[model samples]
Target chain A: MILLLACVLWCVAFRCHEWLQSRNRTTFPMPVRAVWLNQGVRALAPCLALALCLMHSPALGVLFWLGLGSVCGVCTSVLMAVLKNKRGRAPAGKPPL
Target chain B: MRDTLRVHMGWLHSWLGFLAGLLLLCIFASGTLAVFDTEITHWMQPEVPLHTRTALTPAALNAAAQAVEASERQGFSTFLSLPSHRDPVLRVLHYDGYEFTGPALSPETGTSFAPRETAGGQFFYNFHFSLRGGDHPGVQLVTFLGLCLLVTLGSGLVIHLKALWPDLVLLRPFGPRPRAWVDAHLIAGVLFLPFILFMAYTGTAIHARVLLPAQSFFSPSPAGPPKKSAPKGRLLQAGPPLPPLAPLITQGRERLHSPDGNLVLFTADDVRIFRSDASGPFLTRDHADFSRKDGHFLRSVTRSSPTVATMQLVRGLHYARYAPLTLRWLYFLSGLAATALAGSGLVVFLMKRRRSSGENAFFRLAEALTLTVITGFPIATLGLFWANRCLPVALTGRIMAEIDLFFTLWTLFAIHALLLCLRRHAAAAWRQHLYCLALAGGMLPLVDLLSGSHPWGDGAMLFVTVDALAFLSGLIALFAAQHLRRPAT
Candidate 1:
């Protein structure tokens, strides 16, 4: 039951994130090349957190996963913004292209 | 007036939550801990020996009641709670027309001993529902704050709606004003919105007895005495002597289909009633909670309304008692997040005031509030528990003494926080305050084990658990202090 709930929450959470980013496209830099490596690493965090917590306390595991997912998502998004700004080839904080 | 209402509600939510957030943070954190108040209480005082439940003989029960009644006749209402496996104490509670006191009565020996007035679990429970004061004004204030919370929640949602993705998928160590606030509010709010709404709505309704249509509906007019109905059946004249209540208890249990059900003998007469209603699940709010009111268990049923039942249901949901362990963990985590949201909101509001913004009256006020309630209250709470352990057992008026200890510590911390805030080093003040919190929290269990009559047995585990949680939280706050010290990257 928890697994199902977690999966559903993850799907909905990702979709919501996508929707919000779509609305504020100007300040956000486009993934210049579909950076799978960074996104994959970010996605692994929640999975690993869940796996580790499953042994000691499954409930704590859920919290760990959720927290890890939230942290990773924020870091990568900020990194994308900073990296794009540094390349100097990026568009000035434009109205969505 | 319409615009004023909108603007005031907006301002009310913003400032109330922003100013009260630190206190509310403590309230929420403590409240979540209160779910297992009794369990925690038992865990805290492990010295109370456990005994197997033997059959309740008429003689033993009668003796217990007689003892309780004698105690009650001194201008206090009294109760005798039967022993259960989880808690071996036969709970006896009485109000001496001025204050409430409870003592544990041993069913095996029919001897009563005053339990320590340690606010351990009840502190969290009482603080949330009644804010450590009695009902009425406290409930009213908390309800008012709940409305403001709703407003803050709505505005925070609006402000964070643009950055919801980063909130979900992002973790930034450094950020600009709006971005950090937006991210903090988004993650905190979205994740805990359901829990917060449930808590606020249910908390408001729990005291519906004092508010709205219920109060107006039930209140008698001041001009006249209540009009009485004509008597029915000559009021049953006089009937049988109280049939040795133990037999009636057995009969009532058989009828109720659950031996676990309790029996109440109203007035020790023929009007004996047995109740075994399911107080376990969704039925908790039912005034017919056969488990709670022993004497009037049956009579209360006819007078109850659907609204009362619905309100109780909300109360149960808000308290999260019937929830399974997994769901409880979810609620606890969500509660912590809610506290974070409230705390972060205050931090954001304070941060927005540039040093040049006229020394920002609001910023100074926020800093003061954060210090007093956020730091001071926890210190006071810790002290109250310490007093429970340290105070001599022969000490009288235990309840008032404990509460006084809490307020005294609170006042002291508030004064200290104010003095520190005056020094114009708000961040450093917070760090120092957190160190004090850590010291007090870390010492509570040790004090309990060392000072109390009871040894540091398995029973003290609750205190240990709470102490550990407090210490971890204090460490987290210390880390936060460090984070605050760094210049914005």
Candidate 2:
């Protein structure tokens, strides 16, 4: 459904954050690539959702985008929790971090 | 530099946002619920059998009119309304003070089902527009508040202009109270800006009739009581029989160019058939009139002027009666977000001044009011639903009793809130009130089940959807209450 797709888009945004945090940063702030990667996904989530909704109805698509935006916040919180847990656990053959 | 426009706008934003946000919170919350007003009414009155969602037939009009006539015999000035997409029940409604509550007549036959007298969904719809104040003041007052809300939003946006987009997605749930609430306010405000603006614009425009009575923005629709030549003497006696409905329906549809249109208005003289211009982007109330006595074609009412048509479009956008189910749900979600936006703004205001005004009596008073209005109103709303089922059916003034319960519960919560603030237990009061909201919302479905309504199995989707929604809201409230369980600083 649209809600799940929206959630996946949101989760994908958070996954970008996970990717950034998991990067091998020699210093505290991390490198430029990781920062862009996180910011890029965060920005793309909304535009992609808007684009998907706009294909259905041009006039009302904006409203749908708003609804999706609201849902994405809640979904991102939920999905981030799952992605965090997955990342927190060590790799399949490795021990816990 | 300290006295620049940004600082002035910030001052305006805080003052205006808090003041307007409180009232807007009530209006927004109730308005969101009012989207499914008919379904709520369906859940409230368990006696009436759910009819299939279909267009109201000509026979439904005859039945609705007959039911109105029966009420008229009792000295009640009544009107008939046929089913529409949002509310697919042909019912006869009579005004009680400023709200309408009456019997649901059968669509196939003219027989009226004597449902329990309750201040049904009309209570919320009426509350949104008039706040129970008649045409003179309530409508205009709500419109003024709406204008204030528009200004408040503008000021808030200007104050946050520099960082609006940069912090747009930021919401720090675990941060300090001010940071979290500021983030909430910002996210809700930025995301739902269009929804809030659209509703405020369209809602104020449609209700502007009260402030400026001369402007005929759309052809004024006659409602409530008969306005023209009907004699007042024999109104209770039912002087004449109604002409056949089928031929008039046919003529009205042919003239208006929509088969789904129905007779929304009827008197001894003229019957009006309302058709939504469905093919367009906006909804409309274009109708054709015919003589009720002989079924003669009277006039075709249309909003043709570009100005009036634009007004009609805004009006349609406000109610959104023409929207398909998906669009309606979309509107409903956006409306909920708007309500949340107003609510979060209130929390932000309270938390921002907490340190400076921690012991100030006026600050305490405002915080108490915020708690009472935001959480207490939902408790009162759920109380209204519960009262309808629990009150003795044979009790005198049962309908009034239900309405009284709503106001009485709200007042009691206000008193409770004020007492909590006086005792310096406002934080405790917030937590307790959230629990009350959780109980009120969570128990709604169970309450319906206990009342033998069968909300889940074998019940109509209207009843099922309402209960499921109430339960979902209850869970949300419970989650928030738990989120605030940590001891207050």
Candidate 3:
């Protein structure tokens, strides 16, 4: 269960931009759809992680895992930004293309 | 009012959050540490031998009851606490007008253990509420700031609500300073909005009881004139007859239907045995009251009522007494994010003003004070740990000495940062203090190992968590110091 949750979370988290970028305006004219999709995955990944915790941990443990998963996702995103920047691949200090 | 609604909300978020942000940082930071206050207290006082998970024996209860009586004769109002999963030592504690001060005992022999006299983790816990001021004044200030936080949070959402979805996972830390800070702040603010709002609301609600006038909350006239209050918690003359605690424990357990019942409060007339609710994950106010005189079962008190249970739940959420280790860590992490939210908001406030308004005295002063509070607090906290490790155990008021070191070091560092800022050495100040934080926080384990009273060599992971966390925190600070802001080009 933990491994499945991790796989799902990592897939949704690291590939979030790809999910966004793949949304061509022709099929999804409203930007809200892409935004909703991004938000859904980000939100769902934590819930999935917490669902896994609920199998073994108590309710509060599940709540903690939920919060932990979200914060870790954000922190990992930040770390990825820095690492990408260090590798000279990030388009920092400029608006998104 | 500002020209536009968004502009006005932005202004409100910046000023209100910035003004209260410093206090919030300390409040939240201290509170984060406080989530593990008891665990940290256990860690700081390493002399109290860890107990195997066992129920309290009747002999142990009698011994602790006698000890309580003896302490009461000395004018201390005492209560007995049985072993639980968190802190396994039996303890007899009294409110010293500041903290739970008393003796910890072994359940087998019921003899007291002499742990070191450090302020322990309660200092952070109390400081989180009152900032070490008298409880009334401190509570009022904290509440007012909490209200301000609510206002700031509301206005911040108004400004950033539109971008919440679009920028859900975007963080560009390597961007230019202002942009990076904005993105970072937005990400934290958006991601932890529920937690931020809940903490601010529930925390204030817990402290908001004082806001009501005494007359409003209580009946001015009761059914009868209040009976002359008995001299409560008084120790009886030696060998005063009392019922054995075993039956009460058994009965309480039978009534509550939870095996892990603990005798929390003891008095001449009655004793209270608290146990976690079977359906609830963590603990709640579910207990059975037993008469101490004859060990007769009194009515059980359960917070299953919606109104009473809700209030108790809010209190539980605030104090986190009900949390297991996992929930406690979640509370701790959310608290750190809340601190960062306050911190990055403050930095962006100054960065925007510095660029647009130019570096005036007010901006420089704010920057210095920000640097002082943000860096100085950790430095001070770590210094307290070092003082705990280094201070002579036999020294009178050794705990006070550790507390004094915290304040002294924090004040000195703040003043130094301020002076350096005045000399236009902001970058240097940040770098120096971050290095100091790394040093103070990193070297704690080695210091603990040298003290020989530590649990590091003893292979107890419970006690070593504190040292391990400090080392990790130090490493983060060292990494941050490496990336200290370059002077504005």
Q: Who wins the DockQ comparison?
A: 3
DockQ of each: 0.14, 0.14, 0.37
Model 2: how far is B266 from its true place, Å? 2.1
Interface CA root-mean-square deviation for model 1: 7.2
Worst 10 residues of 2 chain B by lDDT: B230-239
lDDT of 2 by residue, B142-208 (tens): 8988888889888888888887654445454444556556666776787678778888988988877
Deviating ranges (above 4 Å) for candidate 3:
A1-14, A17-58, A79-89, A93-97, B1-3, B212-242, B261-263, B276-284, B356-359, B455-459, B485-489
Please give the RMSD of candidate 3 to the true structure.
4.5
For all candidates in order, the CA lDDT equals: 0.57, 0.72, 0.75
Point to the candidate with the largest TM-score.
3
Q: Could you give candidate 3's per-residue lDDT for residues B203-288 as a string of tens digits? A: 88878766654567655677877866434344443223457777777788778777652646665567788874322433366888
- For residue A13, give model 3's deviation from the true position in Å: 4.6
Choose the strongest candidate by lDDT: 3
Error of 2 at B389 (Å): 1.5
Per-residue lDDT of model 1, residues B120-228, tens digit only? 4665677776675565677666666666666676665554555544545443234454455645655567655656776766776666555554446666677878676
Better of 2 and 3 by lDDT: 3
| TM-score of every prediction relative to native | 0.73, 0.84, 0.86
Q: Please list all clashing residue pairs in model 3, or write none if there are none.
A: none
TM-score of 2: 0.84
The positional error of residue B222 in candidate 1, measured at the CA in angstroms, is 5.0
